[model samples]
Target chain A: MDLKDKLVSSFMAFEDGIDVNDPVHDIRSEAIKNFETKGFPSKKEEAWKYTSLNNLQKIDFSVFPKQESALEYKDIKKYFLHEIDTYKIVFVDGIYSSYLSETTHDGVDVCLMSSALTKPMYRQIIELYFNKIAKKEDSLTSLNTAFSKEGAYIYIPKNKAPRKPIQILHLATGNEASLMLQPRNLIIAEENAEVQVIERHQSLTSNEVFTNSVTEIFAAKDARVDYYKLQNDNANASLIDNTYIDQKDNSVVRVHTFSFGGKLTRNNLNYYQNGERIDSTLKGITILDGKQHVDHYTLVHHAQPNCESHQDYKGIYDGSSTGVFNGKILVDKIAQKTDAFQQNNNVLISDKATLNTKPQLEIFADDVKCSHGCTIGQLDEDALFYLQSRGIPKKEAGALLMYAFANNVLESVRIPELKARVNKLIANKLGVRLGFEL
Target chain B: MLKINDLHAGIEGKKILKGINLEVKPGEVHAIMGPNGSGKSTLASVIAGKEEFEIKKGNIELDGEDIEEMAPEERSHNGIFLSFQYPVEIPGVSVTNFIKTAINESRKAQGLEDMPANEMLKKIREKAELLEIDRKFLSRSLNEGFSGGEKKRNEIFQMAMLEPKLAILDETDSGLDIDALRIVANGVNKLRGSDNAIIVITHYQRLLDYIVPDFVHVLHDGKIVKSGGKELALELEEKGYDWVKQETVA
Candidate 1:
C-alpha cells in the first residue's frame, strides 16, 4: 500500500493501545479523518509548488515499528549538545528511551508527552494546550496528530526559570528496513517563566527514515522562550517539521533552525501574537550540498497592537541542492504600532543549484511598519579572487567566502557551545578548516 | 628578477596590453608611469596572474621560468605580490587571521610546517608596526568599514608580511594622504633588499619622490613609449603625460 493509505489503515490498531473514551482520542480520530480527506500535499498546491511530496508519498513507509531499539551514548553523543549539561527527553523509533534520557521534575516538567496525556493530574493542562495552536486543517500536521503518541512535554511554572536548558532528541535507529515516525511535542512557559530548548532528529544508519513531527509552544505573559531545531540527518532520511508558537503580552520567543543535511526537509514555522508588546523572532541558517533539498515556509500573524516580529533566514546551496523560502506576514486592522521585518537571503554556489524565494504581506493596519527583502546570488567572484590572490587555494577561498556570507545570522545564537558546534559543522560541510574560530 | 617578452594580454575580446616588453634585475626599482587607461594596472595584474585578462601573446618569466599558465596562488607561492588599487572587503575575517592563513598556506605549498605561534605573532607585530598600524586594527575584519587609506595600508601590510621577491605596487598611493603615503613608502623602503625587485605602477610622480626608482618608463596605448632614469619621472610630472602621448604619436 501507499504511505497515506497505510497510515489510514494503521489508525485503527493505533487507537487500540490508548484509552478510547479520552477526549484526545476524539481529536485524534477527527485528525485522521482530516488526513484521510486531504492526503499528502501535491505540487499543484500554491505553497508546495517548489517542494513536492509526490515522490515521498510513493515510498511505502512503515507507519509503526515492531520493537523498541537501544543505542549507546558514546556512539550518538555528537548529535547532541553534549558540551553542556541539560535535561534530555529522548525517543527512539517512536518509543521513549529511558537509558539515553535524563528528564527532570524539580520545578518544571521536562518529561514525555505520553505521561502528560495518560496521567490524571496533567489532563487539564493537556486539554487546554494540546493541538490547540497546531493547524487542524493542514494534512501533514493532522497526520502527525493522528499518530502523536510519544514526544517531549515541557512546562515551566509562573515566575520561574529552569536551572538549565532542555533538549528534546528523536533518534531513528535502523530497526526496520524503512521507518516512519510522528512525534508531537508540547511546551508551555507560564507567566514570567523562561526556558531554552534544542531539538534534533537523527538516524543511526543509512536506511530510509521519514519523520513527520509537530510542536506547539505557548509563551504566557512576560515569558521568554528560545527554541532551536538542528536538522542534520543522513542522505536517506527526510523530515517535515511543523512548529506553532503563541505569544502572550510582553512575552519574548525566538526560534532558530539550522538545516545542514538531509535528502529532503521542510520547515513550517508559524507564530501568533495574541497580546500586546509581544516579541517573536525566527532565524535560520541552511547549508546544503549534494542532492539535498530544504524548504522554509513561515508565517507571523500580528493581531494585537505594540507587537514586534523579526524573521531572518540565510541559505547556501551547492552541488545540485535546491532551496525555497516563502515568508508571509499579516497585520490585523487593529494592530497599530506593529513592527514586523522579514529578510531572506540565499547564495547559490553552483549553476546547477537553485533557489526560489518569495515574500507575502497582508496589511490592514494603517499605523504599522512592515518590511521584507529577498536576495539570491552566487558567491562573489571578486571576493574569492581576493582570497585566492593572498595565497589561499580557490576551494578554500570559496569556503571562506561562503562562511562570511552565513556568519551574520550566527551572531544572535545565545548558546556558545551550540554556536561552536554549528561553526564546526559549517566548516566540515564546506570541506575546509577555517584558520580562526568563528 | 622578472621579465616580460613582448607580452600581449586583454580581457574579453578587447586587447589591453599590446607588445609590452620590460625587464627588472635584482636590487633595481622600475616605475611604470602612465595616464589613466594606459594599461599599467593590467601589466601588474597580468604579472600577478589574474585570470580575467587573457595573455594573447608572449610570455612572463620569473627567475627564468615561464608562468603564463599558473594560477594566482601559484604565482603568489613563487614570490610575486600585487598590492591592489581597490582592495576587496571580506567581513568576519580578521586581518591577523587572514594574514596567518595566507602565510601558512604559502608555507604549506612550499612543503614547510606551520610557523611556530610565537614566531608568527612576532613577525606580524614587526610588520604591523612598520606600517604604523594599530594593534587593535589588526583584529578587525579585513578592510571592512575601513577608509580608503586604511585599505591601501592593509595591502602594504600584506606585502610586508609576505615579503615577496618581486613586489608590484599598483597605484598604492592613489587613496592615501601625504602622511599615509610617507608611512607606506617607508614600510616598502624597509622591506627592500638586494635580492628583491620593486615595480611601482602609478600615475603621479609624487610617490616616486618617496621611493626613488632606478629606471622609469612612460607607458601609453598599451606600449612602453620611453625608458629612462629616475629623472624621467620628475620630467613627466612637470610636462604631464600629454607630452609622452604627443611624443609617442609624433
Candidate 2:
C-alpha cells in the first residue's frame, strides 16, 4: 500500500492500546479523514511551488517503530544546550525516554503530551487549548494531528516563570528500516508569565527518518515567550515543522530558527496578533550545502491595532543546495496603526545553488505600515577583495562575510550559550575557523 | 624599496597607468601628485597587486623580487599595504579582530605562530593610542558608520599595526580635517624607518606639509611627467595641475 494509505489503515490499530473513547480520539479520527481526503500538498499549490513532497511520499515510511530504543546521554549530549541547565522532554523513536528526560511539575507543567491527553486532571487544559489554534485545513498539520500521540506539553502558570529554559528533543534511532514521526507540542505561557523553549529532531544513524512535527504556542496577556528551533539533523533526516503562535495584549513572542544541516526541511511559522500592543518577532538563519533544502514560509496576521511584527531571515546556499522564503503579512481592516516589517536576504555561494524568495502583503487597512525587502545575490566581490587585501585568504574572507551576513538575525538571541553554539555551527558550516571568537 | 619599470596596466582594455616608471629606496617617502583621473590611484593599486588592473607590459619589483605574478594577499605578505581611498565597511567584524586576523595571517605565511594574546593586545593598545583611537572605537564594527575623518584615521591605524615595508597612502588626506590630518601624519611619521618606504598619492599638497616627502612626482595621462624635490609639491600646490598639464602637453 502507499504510505498515506498505510497510515490511514493503521490508525485504528494505532488507537487499539490507547483510550479509544477519549474526545481526542474523535479529533484524531476527524484529522485522519481530512488527511486521507487531501493526501499531501503538491507543487501545483502556490504555497508549495518552491518545495515538493512527491519523493518523500513515494518512500514506504513505517508509521511506527515496533520497539523503543535506548541512547546514552554522552552519545547525544552535544545536541543539547548542555552549557546550562534546562528542563528536558526527550523522546526516542516516538516513545518517551524517561531516562534521558528531566521533566518537572514545580508550579508549572513541563511534561509529556501523552500524559496530558490521557490524564483526567489535565483534561480542562487539553480540551481548551489542544489543537485549537493550529489550522485545520493544512494537510500536513492534519497528518501530524492524526498521529499526535507523544510530544512535549508545557504550561506555565500565571505570574510564574520557569526557572530555566525547556528543551524538547526527538531522537530517531535506525531501529526501523524507515521511520516516520509526527510529534505534537503544546506550549502555553499564562498571563504575566515567561518561558523559553528549544526544540530539535535528530537521527542517530544513516537511516531515512522523516518527521512531520506541529507546535502550537499561546502567549496570554503580558506574557513573554522565546522559542528556538535547531534543525541540524543528519544527512538522511528530513523535517516539516509547523508552528502556530497566538499572542494576546502586551505579550511578546520571538521564534528563531537555525537551519544548518538537513536533507530537506520546511518551516511553516504563523503568528496571530490577537490583542493590542502585542509584539511578534520571527527570525531565521539558514546555511545549507550539499543538495540540502530548506524552505521558510512565514505569516503574521495583524488583527489588532498598535501591534508590531518583525521578520528577518538570512540564508547562504552553497553546492547544489536550494532555499525558499515566502513571507506573508495580513493587516486586517481594524488593525490600523499596525507596524509590520519583513526582510529576506539570501546569498548563493555557488553557481549551481538556487533560491526563490517572495513577499506577499495583503493589507486591508490604509493606515497600517507594512514593508518588506528581499534580496538574492552572490557575496560582494568588493567586500571579499577588501578582506583579502587585509591578508585574510579568499576562502576565509568569503566565510567571514557570510558569517557577518547571517549573524544579524542572531542579534536578539537572549540565551548566550545558545548564541555561542550557533556561532560555532555557522563557522563549521562555512568550513573556516574565525580568528576571533564570535 | 619599490621599483616600477615601464609598468603598463589598464582595466577592460582602457589604459590607466601607461608606462609608469619610478624607484624608491628605503627610508624615502615619495609623494605622487596629480590631477583627477591622472592614474595616481592606479599606480598605487598596481603596486599593491590589485588584480582588476591588467598589467600589459613590464613589472613591479618589491626589494628586488618580481611581485607582478603575486596575489594581493601574497603581496601583502611581502609587506605591501594600500590604504584604500574608500575603505569597505564590514558590519560585524570589529576593528581589533580585523587587524588581528591580518597580522596573524601575515605571520602564518611567514611560518610563524599566532602572536601571543597578551602581546597582540599590547600592540593593539599601543597602536590605538598612537592613532588617538578610543578603546570603544576599537570594538566597533570596522569602518561601519565611521565618519570620513574616522575612516582615514582607522586606515592609518591599520597601517601602523601591519607595519608594512611599502605603505601606499592613496588619498589618505582627502577626508581629514586639520586636526585629523595632524594625528594621521603623526602616526605615519612615528612608523617611518630606514627599513620601510611610504608612497603618498594625493591631488593636494596640504598633507605633504605634515609628513614631508623626499621626492615629488607629477603624473599626467598615466605617465610621470614631472619628477623633482619636496619643493615640487609646494610649487604644484601654488601653480595647480593646469601648469603641469600644460608642461606635459607642451
Candidate 3:
C-alpha cells in the first residue's frame, strides 16, 4: 500500500483499541481529518524547500506503548528535581506521570489535559485558543494533534503573577523497538499576569526513537512570559518540535531554544504580534557534531502598528556535520512603524562541514524598518594565535574562543539554573570541559 | 650576548636584509640608524623569529646557540624579546593575564615551577609603578583601544615584566610625544643592567639624546655602511639620510 493508505490503516487500528467517546477523542478525530486533507508537505512547498522530511515519512514506526512498569520517584528525580524551588510536572513516554509531579502555587493551575478536559471552564478555553494559532497545513502539527493523548495544561489567572517558574520535563522511556512519542502542551497567561515556563525533553534509552511534539503559548494583553526549551535527546534519536507564540497589546515574550543533541531534529518557531506596542525577542543556539543535522525555522509577524521584534540564532557545527537556518520577517500592510531585525551566524570547524543559511524580510508597509543578514565561516585565526601565545594549547584555545562566541547568545537566558544546564550540554557537545572551579 | 652573522632575509622573493652582521655584548647599547626601507625592522624581526619573512642566508644566535630554526615562542623562552613597531591588539585578554601566562610558559620551559599568584601580582604592581603606568591599565584588555604612546609604553611595561636578556626596541620612538618619549626612555634606562644588552633601532637622533648608545651603526641599502662612536649619530642628524644615501652610492 501507499504511505497515506498505510497511515490511514494505522489510525484505524489505533482508534478501534482506544476509547473514543469523550471530548478529547472527538478533538483527536477532527485532527486526524485535518491530517488526511493536509498530508505531509514536500520540497515543492515554499517553507519546506530547504528542509525535506521525505526520510521521516519512509519510516514505519509504532506508536509508543503504555509504560506499565512502575518508576520510582528517586530514579527520575535526577532529571527534574533540582535545588530551585518551582512548580514541576513530569511526563513519562508522552503521558503525564502524576505521582512524580508537584506544584505549590495558590493562584496557578496545573493539571493533565486529559483529566482537565472533563471541566467546562477548561474545555471552553482550550476550544477557544488551542490549535487555533498554529497552522494545520503542516503535517508535523497535524501529526502532533492526532497523537495528543497525554499532555500538560498550565493556566495563570488574570492579574495574578506567580512567584516561581513552572517546569515541565518530557521523559521518554520504552524497551520496544522504534517507539514514536508525541508530546502536546498548552500554556495561557491571562492579562497582566507574569510567568516563566521551562520545557525539557530527554530520553532514557539509547534505542532508535522519534519524538514529534508541539507547544502553543498565548500571552494576553499586558502579560509577560519567559519560555525556554531544552532538548538533549540521545544520539540515536530524532525529533520535530513546533512552538507557536501569540502576544497581545503591550505584552512581552522571550523564547530561548537550546538544541545540543539529536541525530536529526527540526524546530519551527513562530511569533505573532496581534496587538499594538508589543515586543518579542527570540534567541537560540544549536551545537552539533558527527553527522548530526539540526534545522531551525523561525518567523516573526507584525500584524499591528508600532510593534518590535528581534531574532538571533547562532550555531557551531563540527566533524562532518550540517546545519540549516531559514529565518523570515513578515510585516503586513497595517504594520506601520514596525521594527524587525534578524541575524543568523554559523562557525564551521571542519572543511567538510556545511551550513545553508537563508535570511529574508518581507515588508509591505512603507514606514517600517526591517533588516536581515547571515555569516558562515571558520574561527578568527588572529584570535586563535593570541590565545595560543598565552600558553593555552591549540585545542583548548579553539574551544575557549568558541565558548566565548556561543556565550553571546547564552547570556540572554535569564534563568540561572537553566542557563547553567544548557552551558554544560554545550560544553559536552564541543568536547571541552567547563572551566568552573569550586 | 646576541650575534647575527651575514644575515640576509626577504619577503615575497625580494631581498631586504643583504649580508648584514652585528654583535650585541652585555652591558652595551647599540643604535642602528638607517634610511626608510633599510631593513632595520627586518633585522629585529629575523632575530625574533617572525615566520612571515624567508631567511635566504643567515644565522642568528642567542647566547651562543643557533636560534634561526627556533619558533617564536621558543625564542621568547630563550630570553630574546622584540618590541614591535606596531604591536597587535588582543581584545578580551587582560594585560596581567597575558603577561602572567607568558612568564609561566617561559618558566616551565626552563623546568621551573609556576610562580605564586600573590608574588606575581606584587611584582607586576611594582614594575608598573616604575614605568609610570597606571595600575588600572593591567586590568584592561591588552593594547586594545590604547593610544600610540600608550601602546609604546605598554610594550616597555611588558619588557619590564618579562625581564629578557636581550631587548630589541624596533622603531619604539616613532609616534611618541616628547613627554611619552621621555617616559619610555626613562623606563628603558631603569631596566638596563650589566648582564643584559639593548638594541635600539631608529631613523632619527632625537631618541639617541635620551638613551645614548655605546656604538652607532649607519645602515643603508640592506647593509650597515659605517660603524663609529655615539658622535656619528649627531653628525647623521646634522646631515640627514639623503647625504648618507648619496655617500653610499658614491
Candidate 4:
C-alpha cells in the first residue's frame, strides 16, 4: 500500500483498539473518515499556498505513549508558570493530571474532556458544538478531530463570573522520537457569564515533537470571554493550532495569541459574530528568529446585522525567519450595518527575513463600514534616532522600541497573568531578559 | 562649551548649512534666526548627531572633543542635548519610562550607576512640577496624544531631566501659545547655569522676548549673512526675511 493508504490503515487500527461506543468516540470515527477522504493539504490549496504542511506528511508521527517519567512542577513553574493567582489545570501528554491541577472558585466547573464526556449534559453540548465552528474544508481541523484523545472542558454557568482566570497548561513529555499530541478544549460561557481562560503549551523534553491542538469557544448572549493562547514550545517543536470562536447576541469575545517559539507554527483563528449586537476582537503577535516559520490565518465573519469585528495581527521577523498573515473579513448581505476592520503590520529586523501579509474584506452589505490595510516595513528611523539621542545604545534602543511596538497589543489583554506570561515569552524570543533595565 | 567651524550639511544631496560658523561659551545663550528652508533645524540635528543629515565639511566641538563623526548617543553622553521642534509620539511607552531610560542610559554612559527608583521618582516629580506639568502626564504614553504646548513642555521636562551642558532648542516655540512659551522659557532659564549653554533657534521674535538671547544671527540661503546683538531679532521681525535676503545679496 502507498503511504496515504498505510497511514489510514494505521489510524483505523489505532481507533479499533479504543472504545467507539461513546459520543466522542463516534465523533472521532466520523472525523477519521473525513480525514481519509481529504489528506494533507498542499501548496495548490488557496489558504495553504503560503504555508505548506507538506513537511508534516513526510514524518511518521507516533501516537502518544504511556507516561514513563515523573512530571515535575518546579521546571514548569520556573519556565512557564508565574506568580499570578489563577485556577491552574495541568495536562501532561494531553491527559488531565489531577495532582497538578488546583482551583479555588466555586461558581465554575473545570474537568477533563474525558470526564465531561461521560456526563450526558456536557456530552450533548459537545456533540452539538464540538468541531462545528471550524470549516470542514480545513484539513488540520479534521486531523485534530481524528486524533483527539485528551482535552480540557470548562463550563461557566449563566449569570456567573469567575473572579480569577482559568489557566490551562499543556506539557509535552515522552521518550519517543516524534510525539504527536492533540489537545482539545471546549469553553462554553452561558448567557451573561464572564470568564478569562489562558491556554499555554510548552515542551518538557528536547525531542522533536508535533503538537496539534484545536480549541472551541462559545460565548452566549451578553456573556464576555477573554481568551489568551501562548505557544512557547521548544525550539525543535512544531505546532498546528486551530481556534474557533462563536458569539451570540450582545456577547463579546477577545482572543490574543502570542507565537514566540517553534520551528514551524501555523495558527488558524475563526471568529463568527452570529447574533446582533455581538462583537469580537482578535489580536496576535508573532516574534520569530532563526529558521522558524510562523503563519497566522484569521477569518472574521459578520453573520448577523449590527455585529462588529476587528482584527489586528503584527509580526517581528528576525534572522532568516519568515512570517505570514492572511486575514479575511466577511460581511454578508443580511449583515448590514456591520463594522469590521482588519490590519496586519510587520517589521523585518534582518535583511534575510521575509513577511507575507494579505488583508481581505468581502462585504455584501451597502451600509456596512469595512476597512482593511496591511503594512510591511522596518523600524521607524525617527523613533530609533529619538531613543538613541537620549543616550540609549543602538541595540538597547532597538530592543526597547520593539518591545514598545509589541506592548500596543500586549496591553490589551485583560488577564494580568496571561499578560505577564506573554511579556516573558516576547522577551525570550527577542533574546533579551524580561527586565533589561538598560 | 560648543563651537561650530564652517559647517556645511544637507539632506538627500541638497546643501543646507553652508559654511556656518558659531561659538557659545558656558553661561551664554545664542539665537539662530532664519527664514523658511534656511536649515535652522538641520544645524540642531547635526549638532545632536542625527545621521540623516550628511555633513560634507565642518567640525563640531563639544567641550574640546571633536564630535563630527560620533553617533547621536555618543554625542548625548558627552553632554549634548536637542529639544526637538516636533518630538516623536511613541505609543505604549510611558513618559516616566522614557525619562527613566534616558536618565539610566546617560548615567551608565557616564560611568555612573543607575539611580535608585525612589530618588528617580522624586526627581521626576520635582521637574514635572517646575514645568507646570501634571504628575499624571508621566504615566501617559510618551507624547502619544499630547497637545502642541504639552509636547513642547515635555521637551523642556526632558531637558531638565537630562541636564546636558549644551541644550539646543530647535524651534521649540513654534507651536506653543504665549503662556506655554513662557512656561517653557522659564524652565529653560531655571535649568541654565554657569557651566551650560543654550542655542535658541526661531523665526519670530516672540519667544526671544521671553528668553532673551545674548546674540542673534540671521541665516539666509543656507548661510549666516549677518550677526548682531539680541536687537537683531526685533529688526528682522520688523522688516521680515526679505531684508535679510536683500542684505545677503548685497
Model 4, position A295: C-alpha lDDT score: 90
Please provide, for model 4 over A1-438, each residue's C-alpha lDDT reduced to its tens digit, 9 standing for 90 to 100: 443455567677767656677767767777778878887777898888888766765666666556744577776785444677677778877667777788543777776776666667666787777777866666667767876666878888899977778888877775667777778888889999999888887777777677778988999999999988787777878888888998999999998888887888988888988899998999988888888898998888889999888788888999999988989888899999998888788889999999988887888889999888888889888888888888887877787777878778876798665666677667666775312332
Query: For all candidates, what are the clash counts?
Result: 0, 0, 0, 0
Cα lDDT tens digits for candidate 1, A53-166: 877878888888667787899998988999999999988888899999999889899999999999999999999999999999999999999888889999999998889988
Give the TM-score of chain A in candidate 3: 0.93
Predicted complex 2: DockQ? 0.71
* Per-residue accuracy of model 2 over A1-438 as CA lDDT, tens digit each: 788889899988898878879999888888999999999899999999999988888889888867768799999999899999999999999889999999999999999999999999999999999999999999999989988888999999999998999999999988887899999999999999999999989999878999999999999999999999999989989999999999999999999999998899999999999999999999999999998999999999999999999999999999999999999999999999999999999999999999999999999998988889999989887777678777888888899899888887888999999999999999999998778777
User: What's the TM-score of each model vs. the native?
Assistant: 0.96, 0.98, 0.82, 0.96
True contacts kept of each: 0.61, 0.57, 0.07, 0.66
How do the residues A1-438 of candidate 3 rate in per-residue lDDT, one tens digit apiece?
A: 544555655777777765677566776777778878877777798777766667766666667556644578777766663758778788876667767788544777776666555566677887777787877767778877776756777788899877778889877675655667778888888899888988887777877677788888899999999988877778878888888888999999999887788777888998989999998988888887887888888889999999999888888888877888988889999999998988888899998778889887888999998877789879886555444433344575577567656766776677787777776676677785423310
Per-residue lDDT tens digits for candidate 2, residues B42-129, read 8888887777889999888888999998988898888999899999988778999989988998898899999999999999999999
- Cα TM-score of candidate 3: 0.82
lDDT, model 2: 0.92
Alpha-carbon interface RMSD for all candidates, in angstroms: 1.1, 1.1, 4.5, 2.2
Candidate 4 wrongly placed segments (more than 4 Å): A1-7, A79-81, A103-105, A119-121, A432-438
Backbone clash pairs for candidate 2 read: none
Better of 2 and 3 by TM-score: 2
How well docked is model 3, in DockQ terms? Answer: 0.21
The two-chain DockQ for each candidate, comma-separated, is 0.66, 0.71, 0.21, 0.60
Candidate 4 CAPRI category:
medium
